[model samples]
Target: MADENGETRRQRNERFEFISPELQVPDGITHVWDWFWQLSGRRHSGPEALTFADVGEWSRLLGIEVLPEEVQMLMAMDDQYLRAVREDQRAARERAQQQ
Candidate 1:
């Protein structure tokens, strides 16, 4: 059923693709996974596909201030690393669900 905002549960779920896990994400960017999915058009392209401008826009959406150091670090992260992080996070979630 749609809510007051006319958003179905599935629609709301699709808004943030990240499947949160018990594992702690590196860099303490709690929403990094969500931001990653939002910024990238497909999972295959990886985070390297994202640009510094994309990070800036993501930060704006998150309403968080990004320091120059953090921006540099984020921009430097390649798709392989991001994909690994995402895989690890999902695996952890699956493990937790089984327990």
Candidate 2:
């Protein structure tokens, strides 16, 4: 249900979406914690994880200045954006190391 502020719970769920294998929240906190750790340790994720700058570049690359929040939802399956963000981070680290 949408609140008076116009934000829906489902919309927020979209933001946390990940490219994880099917997961079922089990009935116990211990098992849930284990599952949570496993999921966090997963090497795979979607492009929605793109950095803010990379997201801007993605908008330029896509010929659409879509808002960051919107892109965050749209790139739910975007591996390219994820790669771009990672590369950007690596470059920044290398530059820092050089200095």
lDDT of 1 by residue, 1-99 (tens): 344467644565578684434546666765554455455643344334666767777679779787786665555544555676566558657968999
Strongest candidate by TM-score: 1
RMSD of each: 10.9, 18.5
* RMSD score of candidate 2 (Å): 18.5
Tell me the TM-score of each prediction against the true structure: 0.36, 0.26
Candidate 1: which stretches are off by over 4 Å?
1-48, 79-99
The residue-level lDDT of candidate 2 at 29 comes to: 36
When summed lDDT is taken over every stretch of 10 residues in candidate 1, the lowest stretch is 39-48
Residue-pair clashes, model 2: 0
> Clashing pairs in model 2?
none
Candidate 1, residue 18: lDDT: 47
lDDT, candidate 2, 9-73, per-residue tens: 45545666734345464464343244223333333443234344654654476565454455444
Against the reference, the lDDT scores of all candidates come to 0.59, 0.47
